[model samples]
Each structure stands twice: as structure tokens, then as C-alpha cells.
Target: MEFRVLGPVGVWNRGAEVPLDGAKQRTVLAALLLSGGRALPDSRLCELLWGEHPPATYPAQIYNYVSRLRKYLGPDVDIRRQWSGYMIHPGDGRLDLAEFERLATLGREAQENHRYEEAADAFHAALALWRGPALMNVTEFLARAETHRLAEMRMAVLERRVETDLLLGRYAQLVPELTRLVGEYPLHEKLRCQLMTALFRTERQADALAVYHEGRRVLAEELGVEPGPTLAATFRAILTAEPARTGGPSVVASSWHAVRPAMLPPAIGDFTGRAAELSALAEVLTGDHACAAQVTGMAGIGKTALALFAAHRDRDRFPDGQLYADLGGNRGNAVEPQEVLGWFLRSLGNAEPSIPRGLDERVRLYRSHLAGRRMLVVLDDAADDAQVRPLLPGEAGCRVLVTSRVSLSDLPGAAVVEVGTLGTAEAVDLLAAVVGKRRVANEPAAARRIVRLCGWLSLGIRVAGSRLVARPHWSLAYFAERLADEQYRLDELRLGTLDVRARLDGSYLALASQSQLALRRLALLEVPHFASWATAAVLGVPRRTGDEVTENLVDARMLEVTGTDGGRRQRHRFHDLVRVFAREKADHVDRMAVAASRVLTTAN
Candidate 1:
């Protein structure tokens, strides 16, 4: 049996294509194949099929699709249930998508060993596997993501194949092909350079010169920049009747022409703690790992402060200077990557007029500028991996430090560092820094109580300290008493526009409706943490639904997963102020009823 997804998704058995009915079934198969034989959770499948608006009976619908697909696939193939989701097992079957990846890997390996002809052959074979548009029949969200990624990979392979062909001395044969490629990818400097080299080698020096001039004109008109150093060097060599230089240009001491884009926010005056996190981030700059790290945590956890502080400590490591963008993931109106790229390009010395209007072109120009330079890019408050992926430096010499409320697990090879609330000792020190060290030391007991009342949360401690600062006469005891009230905890945590309640509300508002409701019910539990089944009872949902909502809440940081109960169910905890906020939004009757039910269940 053979499975193909490069064109229309299909299953072929014994040289004949099996008839698969409905777009949904084909979509199911395509999504499974794209997973590369790994299990995809039912919730993820629903998102892939229906996007943000999955029907209430989505689980049942998915089962129906799987049942029908099983009949089509026959006895040999298995679409069985895994612990978390569905896994497709193909016995004695060939999948074209898998073959393409294998061949592409071989091509890359061969090229690295300087086997140009063999590399070109492998690349060509990989390209031949694509019959048409990938998964054309499926319009699911994940399917679109997969298709876009595949298209990009295909283009990369084409570019690599062309590079190998030029190395193999196939100059005249590449002229027409290179011409077509340059026309298709006008901003591709490498392709343009290859065309120029081909023209020069074939004794058409004038034509080669014409190509360089045309490329320069197009680049200035479209992207608002001159030809990059490599392409410019190729043109210079051709004009002097010298052999074109192979590979990219060497890093010249061209600091005068380079843009030293330093855009980081100032480090906080009294940033403290996370000694381990700081050390880990510092290692990425000097260590053998790729110069990238992702700092993720709940709002007000000091992710931005940590990133800025770490970047400043390693400032001297990046000779080209730092680039910063607040993606505003928590701010609601998050900045798009394209706009951030434009800002970065301008900061890197590209004139606004030369910056390309298209996203891909802008990304290309931005990466080209950072090619060999040692730089640091800090993308703060990113909404997701997609928002930050484009902002990453293309080469290893540059490092990217990203901060987000949600974990951007999709970033390939990113070192993920989860930031949590400051410890009691660190929180106390932060309070002293913000207020006054002598006052906190003078009233040690009261200061400890105040920080504890603030829940050891960074923003909470800062706000408490600020209030103390405003009222110089007020003792620490007085402030601690005010925050001690659970009913007014969030209220007391507010100081002008910097409200702890407001910050938490942003994280809550970002959640789905079901998760929001579940959080409200879970908050009414009146315990520090509870198991998944207990959460299910409170939310009046099935265990699966409860688990999903609980996970989302954890991701949002409204609820924290404390541990597991007997290794079967997850135990979740809510911060004191967060619980207060949830209670404010929850209905009185619903809260009381769930609370009573939990009591009864506990007693039984």
C-alpha cells in the first residue's frame, strides 16, 4: 500500500488508488500523514479540521471519520487509539511525503561533503515527488501550516540544487533556467549571482553586466537597498574580467556602513533572583548550543525584565548590537512580525524606501544584513511561535531571546526556560529594592508578612512596595493588613495603571470561553489545588473536556499545575489573587453549589 499527500491525498493498494470519500476523511488522512506516524490529540485534530469553531459533537465526528477510513485502509493498516490521541500505523506501506524528506536529507548531506553532482541528483529526485499543490483538498488550520512549510522546503531544495549545478560547471545549460528562476524570485541574491556567473563564464560579459545592473535597479525599486556585498562582489569581478568568487562574501570590517541597531529597553534598577535562569541564558551566548533561548511564563512573572537584564549582561558578546521588539502578546494588540522586521531593517541601516513591502523580501534583506555579524535579538511578549519565528536571526553568530506568556514550543531547536514566581526571599528583596532597604529591615516581620500577602508574585511585590513608598508614614504592618483580605486582594494590588488584577485579567481574557468557565468553577474549590476529576465535577464537563480546559488554564498561567494525584490525574493550583478575580467574575449560586458539591464529595 502507498500513501501520497504531495498532490491530492490518496491511498494506493496494489498499484490502484483506493477511493476515499468526503473531504473530511481525506483531511483526516492528510493530518495523520503530516504527523509522520505520531499520535495527534483529538482536540488538535478538531482544530485542524474546523479551526476555532469545532462543533459540540466533534469527538463523535472524528471517530466516524476514523471508522470509515479504517475500512478504506484495509486489514494491513491500523488507525488505532493512543493514550492521548489517534495514531496511524501503516504496515508494509510507502508514504511519498516521508520519501521526500529522506531524499532531501541525503541531498543536504551529499552537498556538505562537496559531492555536487550527487547532491543535485538527490535534490532533483526529492523535487520530483511533488505531484501538485500539497494537500490541495484540505483547508484545515494545521493542513495550511504543513502546506506552507512544505512549499518553503521545496523552494529551498530548488535553490540548493541550483547552487550545486553552478558548482558542477554547468554554466551555459543554467542560463535559461537561472533566467526563469531570477524572474520568479527577483529578490533572491544568490540566484541573481549565479545567473551573473553563468553569463560571465559563457563569454557574455556584457550580458552579465546587464543582469547586475538590472538586479541593482530592481532591488532599489522593490526593497530600497543596493545589491548586497556578495552579489556586488560578483559584479565587480565580472566587470574586471576576473573569475567570479565562489560562496558568500567574507565579513569585512565595514562597521561604518553597518547599522548598530541597539533597541533594548533599560534593565530594571533592582532586578533580582533567577540566578540559575540568568546563568543558563548567559551560556547560550558563549556555549556551543545555537545562540537562541525562549523565556516563557505567566504575566507579571518578570519575563521581560529577565530577558533585558540577561541581554545587557552579554552586551559586549554581540559586536553588531542588540535588536528588541515588544510583540505585545499580552497587550492585546500584538505587533505583527512583518512590521517588526521593517523596524529591525531600518535600525540595521536600510533606508525606509528600500525596505520591501512583501514579508518574505523584508525577511531576506534583514537576514542578509545580519549574515556574519554577532548580534542579539530580543522579541518580547510574543503571542506564539509564528509571531517570533520570522524575527529570529538566520545565522548562529546572532542570538534571539524571546519572552512570551505562552510556551512557544513550535520554535525549532529553541532552548525553553520556564520562569515562575519569585521565591519568598527574592520577593522580599525586590520589595526592599522598590521601597527602601532600611524600612524593610527595620520592620522585618511586617515586611515578610507584606510579601507573603503579595503571593510572592513579582508585580504584586512591586505594587505593594510602590504603595509603601507613597505613604512614608504608613508602617509595613498597615499595608500587610490591607492585602490580608482575600476579598480585596486584587483591589489592593492595583496602583494607578499598573494593576495586578488587570494583568491577570488579560491572561484570563485570552482563554477560550470553556476554560474561563472551568477556571471560575475551579477557583470556587476553596483548596490550594485539586485533581482533574474534581475539576470535571466543578465544571460539569466530561473528564476529557475538564483535562483540556485545565491544560489551557495552566498554559495561560491563571491556574498552575502543582503535581499529579497517584500519577493518574493532574493536581492544579490557583494563586490567591487570581482566585479572588475568578470569584468576582463567577456567579454566587454557581460558586456556592460547586463548593457544596466538593464538600459532600470530600466527606464521602
Candidate 2:
């Protein structure tokens, strides 16, 4: 028999799992196992199992639990009763916690002996023993009492493993994981220091410095303390471009300190699954060949968030610098390319007086500055290809990641990555992140229905999660029940500035009048998805002109294309949330109302 507490509490006899009944039962077993072969006082077990207030019959309850365990555990595992206290001996059976400790000790000894590879492997093995948070299947009292120590133990092992990987010179491989860790534990100086070193070693001095500055800011805001001496010294090395060989973390090339700008926007902390999209984006952003890719999707589909996430993950890979600009793609007055060029020039250490007045001259000077230097430019919410064109560097070593509602395919040699809504699993994970995991675990079926009602749109899910978070007294079922009403789902999916209606409104208003009419009218058609003929027939226009308007809605991201063959064969539809918004628009607006009524009648 093998007992495990690193994740869910359970016992495996041979290869099959042995049923451990009830949270209280699991708690009793975990409390005893964690006592480390020493007997735990009956009172302590009572407190762990039933909180501070145990009933008068607590001793009897303890006796009943242990007696049940003894019968199930058999003669191989010994449960001893000594002076009104309890202890357990695994005997021939193995306990995962004990094995984890043994492996961690071995890893530490290996590191101390300079066997870094063995150390890394040992630490990896020890960590692999954990499936998730420790004692996760137990009662809240037991989990709360034990999780802190286990979590700290895990973080310590992870830190040591990261150190070993750093010694192995796996800089690129360390970046994505480190970015996530640093985001999670922003207050931890050790993780902050490691991330800085890995970044500088990968030739991202700008990003390394940015990490230090962010840490400094967070420290000041939260605790009113500056960075410690170790972090400060590492910052000095990156800023000075000092080379350290077994001496210091001075890893950047001497010439790189000139103008290392780290201008990536802060990544979404609760950004959930997009494994395939992130992998594809990472390949495009970090690979040898391509330097520019446009991440385009429907409004509020999390295009910007994904772009920033990928950019920050590979920020260290681009050695010279990383630059960012918001071209305000959704705005009526998008930021001009010349204005963005001036900002980039200043970040590159060009004096304001030296910046040329003409757009052509600025582009020349900007490209000239980025000619040989490795850089990552993130142009978020771009208006179009024209707004992004001049901002892009002319060098092969530099990369540009742009996010927009429309496909910026007009940009020469740029790849367009179309982002869709989250899958059911990813959608639930995202909702869980925004709301608490415990709440979702308590009401999983409701959680699934909530994300489904959201049409799996990232913004819709976030907004829905935010609503539940604001109304803490509301149950997941209550929220899911509220969302089931289609007429008010969009309204309920709103909480202080995170309105799905507002997000869709921006994209809707950005469309041409003809496209807007087709969009709102098509919503009146009341179908899940439709082809061009449906739209062409509804709009009372010629097939060719109606097709152009429908395709325009697709290009503008106000509507999603359901088919991919091209020309008249193309099919289009609004996401569930987007359809709701369009229908709401149709009902509210006086001019579109008459046409919408006729379209609805025709469809029926």
C-alpha cells in the first residue's frame, strides 16, 4: 500500500486507488501521517478534524475513525493507541511525504557536492511527486493547517531546481516559467533575483532592469521597503553591462547598457489557458525567421492580453531591448505612426531635438537605430497596417507583435494569428481564476454553464467572474441561474468598467453604416450561424454588395466568420454574447428597430 498526501489524500494498493471515504476521514489520516511516526494528542486530532469546537463525544468519534482505519489498513500497517493518543506506522507500505523528504535531502547533498545535474534531476523527481496543492482532498481545517508548510517546501525546492537549471545555462527555457512565478510571488526577492539573472544572461538587460524596478515599486507600495542588497547589486551589473564568470551576475555584454528599454505592458495575472495559441505565438515571436505577427480576433477576445503574455514570456530572448506602443485600434482617433516613432526614438536614447519633423525622416532614423540591435516591439490595439508599418524595425533580429480587432494583413510579410474563444475546459479555468477555485469546485456544473452562457469569450467570462466576486453572497448557481436569462445575460456579465456591452459597442460603432445594418439585422435572423446568402437576402441588397458588407463585419471583428473557403462560400456568425449585444442595439435604436422587426418576421 502507498499513501500520498502531496496532492489529494488517498491510498493505492498495488496500482489501483483505494477508496478513502469522507473529508473527515482523510483529515484524520493526514493529521496522523504528518505527525512523523510520533503520536498526536487526541485533542489535537479533534481540533484538526472538527475545528476548535469539538463535541463532547469527540473521543468516541476519534475511536470510531481509528477502528475503521485499522480494519481497512490490515496487519501490514500498524495503528497504535498509546495513552489516549494515536500514531501510525506504515511498516512495509510507503508514504509519499517521507519519500519526498528523502529525495529533497539527497538533492541538497548533491548540490553541495557540485553535482548540479544530479541535483536538478533529484529535485525534479521530488517535485514531480506533487500532483497539486498538498492535502487538497481533505477538510478545510486540515488543509489550511498543513498547506502553508507544504507550499513553502515546494517553493524552496522549485527555487533550488531553478538555480540548477540556471547553472546548466538553460536561459531561454527558464523565462516562461519564471515570468509566471515572478508574477505570482512578486514580493519574494529570491525569485525576483533569479528572474533578473536569467533575463540578463539571455541578453535582456532592459527587461532585467524592469523586473528590479517593478519589484522596487511593489515593495514600496506594499511594505515601504526598497530592494535588498542582493537585488540592488544584480541591478548594478545589468545596468553597467559587466561580464561575470563565476564571480557575479554581471552577464550582459558591455555595449548593451546603452539604451535597453523594457516597455512591455504588465501581463494579466489571472490569464488562463491558450496553450495552442501561446505556443503558436511563441514560435512566431521567438523563432529565427519571422519577426512580425499580428494577433487579431473579435473584440474583447483577449487579443491584447495574449500578445502581452507571449511578449513577456520571450522578453529575455530579445537581447538588445523590448518596446511597446498602444495604437488605440478601437478608438475613433487612433495614435499616429509619427507620434509612436518619436516615443520609440526617445526610448532608444535619441534626444528630442534630434527627432525629425517629417514622418519619412523619423521612420528612417528609427529603422537606422534598430538596424543591427535585437529588439521586441509590441504594438498593442493597432488601428491598421499603416499605424504599425512605420513603428516596425527594419532589422532581422528584431520582432514585432501587434494585436488588433482587424487583421493587419496589409503589412508586408506579417503573419496574422486569429484568436478564438476559449474551449470549455479553458473557459472554466479562466472563470475559476477570476472567482475563487474553491467556489468553482463547490459548484462545478454551475461554473460550466456560466462559461457556456458567456460564449467562452475571455472578456465575457472575466466580467461574469467579476460580478460573482462583487456579490460574494451570491452562489455560483445563483449567478448561473441569473445568466440563463438570455435577455439579461449581457447585463449580468457586467461589473464596474468590465461591461461586455461596452466592449462590443466599440467594435459595433467602428463599422461602416452598411456593415452595421447587416450585423444588427442578421442578429434579428435568430440563427446560431449563417452564410452570405442569409445576410444578402436579409439586407435587401445585391448578393455581391451584401457579401462585401458581411465580410466587412468579419474583418472589423464585429462578427466571426464560421466558414473558411473564401468568396461567396464564406459563412459568418456573431458569438453568443456579441449576438446579444447586436440584438440589444437593434431593439434600442429607432432607425434599426423597423428594419430589425421586418428581418425577424421574415426569418420566422
- Superposed by TM-score, candidate 1 places the C-alpha of residue 54 at a distance from the truth, in angstroms, of 6.2
> How much is the lDDT of residue 579 in candidate 1?
85
CA lDDT of each candidate?
A: 0.79, 0.78
What lDDT score is found at residue 573 in candidate 2?
72
Lowest lDDT sum, 10 consecutive residues, model 2, at 248-257
Q: Please provide, for model 2 over 1-604, each residue's C-alpha lDDT reduced to its tens digit, 9 standing for 90 to 100.
A: 9999999998888898877667888888888888766566675688788887889888889898988888777888888985347988888888887777667767866876889889889999999999998999888887766675577567767877887788777788998899999999886766777888888888788999999999999866764545644566778877887646455323332132367899887999999998888887887776643457889888888998999989988888888889999887786669999999989888987667657777866765576466446789999888765677678675556788988987653353456688998999999999999999999999999999999999999999999988888889999998888999989988797888888888788888888787887777788765566666666776677886776677677667777666644653666677888778887877445335546446445432
Model 1 whole-model lDDT (C-alpha atoms): 0.79
Instruction: Tell me the alpha-carbon RMSD of every candidate.
Output: 5.9, 24.4
lDDT of 1 at 291: 57
lDDT of 1 at 299: 80
Question: Each prediction's TM-score against the native?
Answer: 0.74, 0.56
